[model samples]
Target: MDRWVGKTAVVTGASSGIGSGIAVGFANAGINVIGLARRTEPIEVLKSQVTGSGSITAHHCDVSSAEDVAATFKWINETFGCVHILVNNAGIFVTGGITDAGDDMISENDIIAILDTNLKGTILCARHAIASMRSNNFDGHVININSIAGHYVPMSSKFNVYTSSKYGVTGFTAGLLNELADHKNKIKVTSVSPGLVNTSLNVVAATTTDMPALRPKDIADACLYVLSTPPTVNINELTITPVTERRL
Candidate 1:
């Protein structure tokens, strides 16, 4: 934590949910945090509420768009210097059976939307983040906000494509790790996968304690734990689930 104070961190999907939690958590610890999302209102609110050694700034970025991502990263470099931490927490779930005949649930647009944000968005962010680290000669951390679906598919409807995207994340994380190791880059990439997080992303709204779920702050804490580790330690993958979560 001392190593990151006064440094920069970027968190996507910061308007709400996990993204917001991560941004606030980092900012609370005296790290200058930039929360990027399509909507800046929520992040602006968060910026106002953050009371800690560090500060929070709100930036608008639609991670799915390459142009938006590029511009956002450019702004980060120019305004904040280098990004010490990038939390790819922006994601969305499209509810519709794969067999959606009416094209309401699983349409072509839905598929593209999910992949663009869940997969391509992460790749784009990582690309720029790596570039930032390389140019600055800084050893940084890339913490991906993945889901349990990345590891396994559960018995559920309307989650097939979402699960597929998560699996892509799993594969991508490993690939990125290999790339970093091959280059001998001190940069660390970690995947924090949580099961049934209690966020608005879930259509069912699992607010009851009886349901197995994790809070956004819990995931944020995991990110902090990873970042807090020694630079020599790289937590390649961390899977978290509520005690009530049953194994399939």
Candidate 2:
């Protein structure tokens, strides 16, 4: 934690929920945080609330767009010179299974939305962030906000696409570790997989079940713990779930 103080961190989907929590946590730890999301207003509010040695700057970025991602990284490099951390937290979930619509089937747009943001967006951010770290010869950490679904299906068929996308993340994390190893890079990659969380993102599940859900801050704490470890220690994957919830 002391080593990370005064460093730069980028947190995607920082407008609300887990992303916002992580951004706030990092800032309070004296890490300058750049929060990216399509909605910058909430992040702006968050920036105003920071009272610490660190700060937060809101940037409008749609991770699904390569141009947007590229521009944001360019700004980070030009302004901060290097990024020490990246939290790939942007994601989306849409209802309806493959055969839900019967003759019509699931919406193609829904599938695209999930994969573009969940899988593709994660890849794009890691790509640019790692590039920045390498070019600067700085060892950095990449943390993907994964889900327990990435390991196994916990619910029904409606979440098929979402689960599949996270599964891709699980695989991506391993692949990235191998790639970094091959290059003898000191950079670290971690997948912080959380179970059901008590956020608007999980309102549907919350209202329908008595099972407890973890809070956004819980996930934030997990991330902080991961980042605080010594450079020699790389947490490959972490899974957290509510106490009452059975392991999926």
Candidate 3:
């Protein structure tokens, strides 16, 4: 932890939920955090509220958009040389079911939106963030915010393509490991799969989900733990679920 006092970290989907929590945690750790999301207002509010040694700067970027993602990374490279960490946490979920329809139905665009943000966004962020690591010879880390949904499908979760997208993320993490190894890069890639988090992402149905759920800060703690490990250690995958969380 002391070794990364003034480094830069880019956290996507920092507007709310787990994303914002991780951004706050990093800022408190004296790491300059660049928060990217479609809506930057919440991030701005969070930045103002935090009293920490590090700072949080919000940027408007739809991770699904190639132009937005590319531009955001370009700005990061100029503003903060060679990112030391990147949290690919931006994601979306269309409420209802896979075949849901009639206002509650998941449309084609909705499917694209979910997959684009959850899957493609992760890939793009990883691709760009590692570029800096290679350029600066910085042994950085890329943390992908995955879900238990990716590994196992729970009953009546009403999640359709969301699970598939996360499954893709699980695969992406594995593939990324090989990509780095092939390139002979030391940058670490970790997939943190959390289960049933009590987060209000504004995407999931606004129900009072009373089931046992993990907090966003819990996920943040897991990420810090991953970072705190000696450089010789590389956590391939970390799955976190509440004690009472049911495993389907």
If scored against the real structure, what TM-score would every candidate get?
0.95, 0.95, 0.94
Instruction: Give the runs in model 1 whose Cα sits over 4 Å from its true position.
Output: 101-104, 204-209
Which pairs of residues clash in candidate 3, taking residues 3 or more apart in a chain or in different chains?
100-105, 101-105
Q: What digit string (tens of lDDT, one per residue) describes model 3 on residues 1-248?
A: 88777899999999999999999998888888999988989999888656678889999999998888899899999988878999999998767667635446678988899999999999998999999888888999999999888887766456788899999999999999998889888899999999878787533324535557788999989999999989888999999988876664
Q: Highest lDDT: give the candidate number.
A: 2
- Encode model 1's per-residue lDDT on 85-178: one tens digit a residue: 8999899898877775656557788889999999999999999998998899999999999988898887666575888889988999999999
lDDT measured at residue 230 in model 2 versus the true structure, 0 to 100: 95
Give the per-residue lDDT of model 2 (tens digit) for 77-133. 999999999999999887667665554456898889899999999999999999999
lDDT of each: 0.88, 0.91, 0.87
Residue 213 lDDT, candidate 1, scale 0-100:
74
